[model samples]
Target: MKLGILGGTFNPVHTAHLRIAEEVRERCGLDRILFVPAATPPHKELAGAIPFADRYAMVAAAIADNPDFVATDLENRRAGKSYSVHTLELLHEEYPQDTFYFIIGMDSYRSLGIWKDFPRLFELANLVVAARPGIPCKDPLALLPVVIRDQFCYHESAHMLRHRSGNIVVFFEETYLDISSTQIRRLVSEGRSIRYLLPTAVEHYIYRHGLYHNDERF
Candidate 1:
C-alpha cells in the first residue's frame, strides 16, 4: 500500500489542505493520505495555540467526506515533542509492507537539516517536496548537509509523483497552494471572515469555539 503523510498543526484544516491531499493522492497514486496533526510542533510553538483535540476534531470533520483522506492523532497520542523522524519510524514498523511518502512544502524542504533526526527520516520514507509559489528550489547543498541533501526527489506536480520510481521513489509535487493556517488565524483574529479560506466545517468550528480571538499570538 502507498500511504502519504501530510503532517501539520492543522490548528484548523482548510480547503487548501484537503485539496493538496487529494491532488497528492491522485498524482502520486496513493491508496490513502493521512493527516497527522502535530501535538507540539518543534519549530512553531505559539502561545494559546488551539488544543490538540480541537485541532484533531476539526481535521476529522474537514476530511470526513473524502474516503481517500484520513486523520491520525499519532503526534497527539505520543509522548514528548512531535517530530517527523519519530513518527515515520513508528509508522514504518507498524506497516512494514507499505511504502510511506512524506508530503511537505518547498519552504519546509529547505529547512529539513534543522529537523530532528532528519537523516533517519529519509531512510524510513520518501520525501515528497511540494513546491510553493515564488519559492524556487534553491541550492540544496546550501540548505542541507551533503548526506541529507541526497535524499530529496523533486516533482513538478502531483501528476508526476504518480508515475515515479516504478513504485519506489520520492515524489515531488510542483503545484503550490496559496492558503496557510497562520494566515487564517490572523484573519480570524482581525475579525475577518474566512469563509473561502478554509473548509466550511472548519470555519464553523473555529467560530463555534471562539478560537483565535483570545489567542494573543494571533
Candidate 2:
C-alpha cells in the first residue's frame, strides 16, 4: 500500500491541511494519509506553539469524519526535537511492507540538505512536493546534492523523477489555500474572525482553550 505522511506543527489543524491531504491522496492514488503532528519541530521555533496534547486533539477532531485521514502520535511519543529523518527511519522500520511517500511543500524541500541524514532521506521514502501553479521551483534538481541528484531520472511522460531504487520525487501541482497557521494565530490574537479558515471544530477548540489569544512569537 502507498501511505502518505504529512508531518507538521499542527498547532490547530485547519481546512487547508485536510484539503492538501485529500488532493495528494486523490492525485497520487494513495491508500491513506497519516497526519503526524510534530512534538517539537527542529526547524521551527516552538516558543508560541500550544501544548502537544492540545495540538494532537485538534488534529484528531479535524480529521474525525475522513476515513482516509489518520492522526498519528509517532513524533509526539518520541523524545527531543522531531527530525524528519528519524521519523522516516522509524516509519520504514515499522511498516516495512508499505511504500512511503512524504508530502512536503516546495519551500521546505529547498532546505532538504540541512535535514538530518540529508541524502539518505531520499532512500527511505519517496518525496511528493506540492507546487503552486505559475511558479516553478528555481532549478530544484541543481539544488540537490550531487549524490542524491544521481539517484533519480526525470520521466517526461509522468512529469516525475523515477528513482533507481523505486523511491521517486513526484512534482505535484496543487491548489493550496493562502491560509497558514501563522496567519491564523495572528488573526486570533487580534480578535479577527477565523471563520472558514479552519475546521469548525478546530476553530472552536482554539477559542475554548484560548490557544493563541495572546499570540506570542510563532
Candidate 3:
C-alpha cells in the first residue's frame, strides 16, 4: 500500500488542504492520504487555543466526502509535542509493508531544517512538497539543508531528489488556492463570510463551536 501522510494544526481544515491532498494522491499514485491534526504543534502555537478534538473534528468533516482521505488522531494519542519524525517512526512501525509519502507544503519544506530529526525523515518516507501561493521554490535543492544536500541526487526531468536511503523527494505543482487558515480565521473574527473558503461542514463547525470569534490575534 502507498500511504501519504499530511500533518497539520488544521485549526480548521480548509479547501486548499483537501485540494493539496487530492492533487498529491493523484500525481503520486497514493492509495490513501492520512490527515493527522496535531494535538500540540512543535513549531507554532495554535491560534485560538482551540482544542485538539475540535480541530480533529473539522479535519474529519472536511475530508468526509473523500473515500481516499482519512482522519487520524495519531498525534493526539501521543504525548508531548507533535513532532514529524516521531509520527513517521510510528507509522513505519505500524505499516512495515507499505510505502509512505510524507506530504508537505513548500513553505514548510523550506523550514524543515529546524524540525526534530528532520534528516531522518527522508529515510522514513518519500517527500511530496507541493507548491503554495506566494512561496517560490525555484530551486528546491538550494533550499535543502547544506549538510544533507550532498546525500541527494536531483533528477531534473522528474523534479525529484533520490536520497541514499532510497526514498525520493518530489516537488509537485498542484492547483494553488490562495485561501489560508489565517485568512479564514480573520474573516470569521471580523464577522465576514467564510463560505466557500473551506468545506461547508468545516465552516459550519467553526461557527457552531464559536471558534476564532474571540481571537484577538486575528
Highest TM-score: which candidate?
Answer: 3
For residues 83-144, what per-residue lDDT tens digits would candidate 2 score against the true structure?
99899988988789999999999888887888888877778899999988887765567657
TM-score of 3: 0.95
- For 90-192, candidate 3 gives per-residue lDDT tens digits of 8888789999999998878989999999999999999999985555566778899999999999888888899999999998677998888999999999999
RMSD of 2: 1.5
Q: What pairs collide in candidate 3?
A: none
Instruction: Select the stronger candidate by TM-score from 1 and 3.
Output: 3
After superposing candidate 1, which stretches have Cα over 4 Å from the reference?
Answer: 133-143, 149-174
Better of 1 and 3 by lDDT: 3
Which parts of model 3 have CA positions greater than 4 angstroms off? 133-138
Q: How close is candidate 2 to the true structure, as a TM-score?
A: 0.94
Give the clashing pairs for model 2: none
